[model samples]
Each structure stands twice: as C-alpha cells, then as structure tokens.
Target: MSSQPYRLYYDRMTSAFVPHVMLEEMGVDYELVHIDTGVDAHETEEFRAINPNMLIPTLGLPDGRTFGENGAQLVMLGDLHPESGMVPRIGDEDRPAFLQWLFAIATTGHTTIRRYSYPEEYSTRYDAQDSVSEAAYRQLTRFYSVLDGVISGEPWFLPRGFGPLDIYTILILIPFEGDALADILDTRPSLARLHAATHARPTVERLWNFYFGADA
Candidate 1:
C-alpha cells in the first residue's frame, strides 16, 4: 500500500466530482477536506496552503508534496499507481492523445460552460453586442457540436479506453446540467452517449449520487 493516502480539498459538489469518482474507482483509501467552495473559504490561508491558486481538488501526498488542478492531479495519480491505468506518465505513449483531449475539455469545453453559466462576468465585455447569455449559449453549442461529432460508444476520450480523460470530460459538465444539459446533448448525440456511458458506470453513479443527488 502506498503511504500517499490521497487528501482532497474541494467543494461539497463541483468538478471535483471527477477525481472523487476516479479515486473510488481506483479503490484507494483517501481522506476528504470539504471547504464548501465558492463561499470563499477556498480563498483563505489554510486552503491556499494546498493550492496557491486557491483551486479545489488539491491532493496532498504522504511524501509531503501536494498537487492541484484536476488534469494534473489525475495524470499524477495515474503515474503513481500504474494499476489505476488512468493516464500516461512523462514517457508513456498515451500521453499525446490524453493530453490533447484534456486541454480540449478544460479549455474549449469547460471554460465555455463557466463563461456562459455566469453571465455577470461576460455581461459587460465588448466582445458581444448580443446578450451575454446568448453568446455563452452559442459558444457552448459550438463545443457541444464538436464533441458530438467526435465521441462514439467508445469508453474513452481517445480510443485508449476509459481513463482520466473520460472521467474529467464527464465531470466538467457537472456545474452545468439539467434542462440545459439535455439541450446541449440534443445538439450532439455523441456527447449524450458519452455522458450516458460515464454516468451509467457503477462507480460513477455511486459518486454522482453522493455528490450531486440534490444539487445537480
């Protein structure tokens, strides 16, 4: 057993759900430190100790090293425990494709969701004469269409089989689901298939129910 028992500092519910599900899937003994994110508890000193950027999902290892950011953390977990089989390390051949879609989801997909979901931030930006909500919807729809065209019934983001990429992609959508999710999925059947597969998995369902039963 590894001495690096994982510790998660995250919101009660958020994209942290992704790695939370991944750890459960890995069946690793871990500890969680719930900070009730967005209450600005995440902005405090104690929380900042783990992640200077004040990000959630920071994992502290037994070696005294800590990590933050969902993408980097999952990739590191995959590296530390090969049995987890979630991602490639510095030298692994799977790195390229895994990293590619990782960036795609985080940047092209996740950011757009957040940008639109919070119209207050973009409402005054000069980028649009249209309503901030409309621009956000348009950006989200474009990405959803792209996702629909790409993913198939395959379990993974790439053809490499289910791993961190798929986990993160599905988890990124947690903040923006419900009727909007259905609408987005309607535009892209592929994403709906991918979402269904991820949510249907027993491990994912367990975490989803626990994290998002009422909130999501």
Candidate 2:
C-alpha cells in the first residue's frame, strides 16, 4: 500500500457511510473530503473531475486513482487490506456467500431503496409517484424477507463474523424511518438483530451521530 492516506469524498448519511465505517474498521489512514449534497457540491465540475458519476463515497486511492460506487470501494479496500479481515479471501469457502450478499445489497437492495425514497426519479407523472413508491415498498419487504432468512450467523450476516457485509446491509436500512423502519424490523427478527448488532459498534454509533446528529 502507498504511504499516502486514502481520500474518501463523503456526505453525511449517504452510501459513503459504508466505506466510512469500513475505513475506520480497517484502521487505515484516510482523509475525509466532505461534499455537502445539500448545496449540490457533488454536482460541481471540481468534484466531477474526480468522479465523473458525481457521486459520494468516491475514493481517492493512494496511487491517485479515484472512483465512485460504494460497493466497489468496499471490495477494493477489503482486498487491499486483507489483514483487516473485512472480506473473505478469494479461495475461502466463505468468499462466494460474501460476494453474493455484497452484490445483492449493492444492486437490488440499493435500487429498491432509491425507488422507495424518491419515486419521482422513476417517473415524471405526479400521480404515479404513490404507486411507484408502494411497489418499491413491496419489493423491499420481499428483499428483507429473503435477507432475514439467510442470516445464519449470530449478530452478523455471516458466520465468519462482522465485516463489510454487515456494514453494507445496515447502510441500506438506515434510510428507512418511522413506520417503514419499524415495519421491517418488527417482521424480521434476524434483520432486527443484525441492525442492533451493527449499530452497537462504537465506530458505527460515533459515525451515525456525526452524520445524523446525536439526537437522531
């Protein structure tokens, strides 16, 4: 690894939270570059030069390569710092299940949440927004059901113990609020346990307060 610290472009409560937690867990030297999404900082040309996608959780590697996408960032960081044990090694039997959950969360889980949170982005018809959100909620519920069933480990998603998978899963769940969050947790015992376990970490608690405020 390069001696230079990794740079993480972040915005509070975004997918950046996953990598933020991962970096802390790895105990790697890193710098945080705050991108205030409230002001559209991520849309600026300056930020775009580093990440063409104009996304948060853009990682600036020690070698100067910058890329967006939190899932890829987690994979890269895990592979780069195997000593952290954040991911199962390529030949490890656990590696397959780890990748399965990681990619599922990154693609399906993330996409479904986006639809639920911002139905307008999926359609221009104002009247259609409710239906879109409702459909997304149904899909999300189903997704959580499947996720809840496969958690064979105690207080974590995999038997190997806490790692990137737990971080990524909790990231998707954080956006849910009020009855929505309650509904998910109340119905899924495993997911509720996982959520509690992830939040119980000191790193996660501190970062959550840092991003969403102590009262949150």
**Candidates' C-alpha lDDT:** 0.73, 0.88
For residues 1-216, what per-residue lDDT tens digits would candidate 2 score against the true structure?
Answer: 578999999887677888889999999999999898889999999999999999887999999899988778989999999988879989998999988989999898998999988999999999999999899888988989999999877779999899988888887786687896898899899989999999999998898787777543
Over the stretch 63-128, how does candidate 1's per-residue lDDT look in tens digits?
Answer: 767778777777777777787766766677767767777778887777776776676666676656
- In model 2, the runs with Cα more than 4 Å from the true position are 214-216
Task: Give candidate 1's error at residue 176 in angstroms.
Answer: 5.1
Candidate 2 lDDT (Cα, 0 to 1): 0.88
C-alpha lDDT of residue 65 in model 2:
96
The clash count for each model shown is 0, 0
